[model samples]
Target: MKIILKVLLYIVLGILALCISEMLFFFILIHSNNTEKGNKTVIMKTDSIAHSKALVVYQPSLMTDSTKNVAYDLAKGLNSKGYDVTIAYPGKYLSTDLSTYKVVVFGSPIYIGQTSSVLNDYIKSVNNLKDQKILLFVTGGADDSEQLNSLEKLFTNAEIPMKISFKYNDKGNENKAFNLGSEIGKE
Candidate 1:
């Protein structure tokens, strides 16, 4: 009986440790993303003919931490390349006029083998984007690039015509995507 009680105590302690670690990771994510005070930025609206500006929206899974920063990295790089780029977080829950940007980038992390609610909301926000040059990006926690194909499908179903898309590691993989954004801006 005493041994059983000891085991129970050990189990309880183990659970507590796990919870603390998880919470630490969550706090870290919130802190990392707190790096900037976000602003609601707007670019010029594209005409019936596509414009030279671009909008990139990134939505990270609520459970994840690192995905929140990639969109900014991509945005800064594109800006360096002389692209009019705007980076917005989907959590702002704010909608922008999609007509303002020639290219709209919808990116998010894959949770439960699919895109998160943030991306879904962003997709829903776009209106009358027919023939618009859309781009898709995804960050996966455990799976492979297979997650990106589904993201592309989501854009296709939403009537977003994607010109290019790519997936990269959520941890420290930003330069390649930045380069990609620059190239996309040039197009």
Candidate 2:
């Protein structure tokens, strides 16, 4: 009986240790992102589109982040190339008039192996986008092929130029995102 109690106590302690470690990892990821990037507020400014300008739309995940987001990374990239950029969240910006911007970037993270609902709705709402450039970017862990393929199909059907889909890592890859944004601005 004593041996059984000892084993039970060991199991409980093991579970507690696992829980603590998981929580620690989560806290680290959140704070790491915050430190690397400043505030994460969505910028909705379109008043400066009279010059070279771009709009980036994305929806951040719960417990994930908005500041260290792939969308903001690309926006920063665009900024590096002298284009005025505004990054906005889909829930707030979907119905916005996008006629002034020269370039529009749709960015989102794959949720449950699919494109996020907010992003999908924003994409559907876009109309009369003739001659204006449209870009698609998605961030996700591991295989995003299914989400990528679906996005490509949507772009192909709409006759929009299909850019690259960025696979998201926990640690944001700002350089790659910046390169893509710079290239878009040059075009």
Candidate 3:
């Protein structure tokens, strides 16, 4: 009986140790991901609508849900110049009508080396803009530029009036992209 109890105790300890290690690993991963996403989320509600009067739709969507980091400086730059801005992600609402917005900006994160399905659907749904203006802004890492540039060409060829910009892992790129947003608003 003593030997059997010892074996059972050893097995339980091993399992407990494994569980603890797994929990620690998962906790670390979740913590890091949250921190990264938190920094990006700072751009949300960044809509300074006083600059440009155009509706700005910034979407950061995975296959799961769509969210956005509002380009406040970009929106503000345009709004400051007197453009009205309305911002949203697909998750906020869906099947949105583009007819109401004269100038529309769609901001998307790079996914699988390309834009998300939500942005693609938005572009496809926009069949008759007549005189509507469209702009696409993309956020991605360094190697993503080639992919982003190519993606921008797709939007431009489709008459989206894209001012393609890429945000590398480096923070400065986002600022650069923000400046590009200003140009996009101007155009």
TM-score of each: 0.63, 0.66, 0.55
Candidate 2 Cα RMSD (Å): 6.4
For model 1 the local lDDT of residue 34 reads 34
Model 1 C-alpha lDDT per residue in residues 1-187, reported as the tens digit of each score: 9999999999999999999998988666544433322455544332324336678877654554445556766676556656677677664445646786676787776544555555665565556666457767776656535666655555533454443333444344577667776776676
The residue-by-residue lDDT of candidate 2 on 19-76, one tens digit each, is 9998987665444322212223455333334457788876665545532367877887
**Candidate 2: which stretches are off by over 4 Å?**
1-50, 66-68, 154-157, 170-172
Please give the TM-score that candidate 3 achieves against the real structure.
Answer: 0.55
Worst 10 residues of 2 by lDDT: 31-40
Q: Give, for candidate 3, the lowest lDDT window spanning 10 residues.
A: 35-44
The order by descending TM-score is: 2, 1, 3
Report, for every candidate in turn, its global Cα lDDT versus the true structure.
0.61, 0.65, 0.54
Candidate topping TM-score? 2
RMSD of each: 6.0, 6.4, 8.4
| After superposition, candidate 1 runs with Cα above 4 Å error | 1-51, 60-65, 91-93, 144-146, 156-172
How many residue pairs clash (N, CA or C atoms closer than 3 angstroms) in each of the candidate models, in the order given?
A: 1, 1, 13
Candidate 1 residue 79 Cα shift, in angstroms, is 1.8
TM-score, predicted candidate 2 vs. hidden true structure? 0.66
Best prediction by lDDT: 2
Q: How many residue pairs in model 3 have overlapping backbones?
A: 13
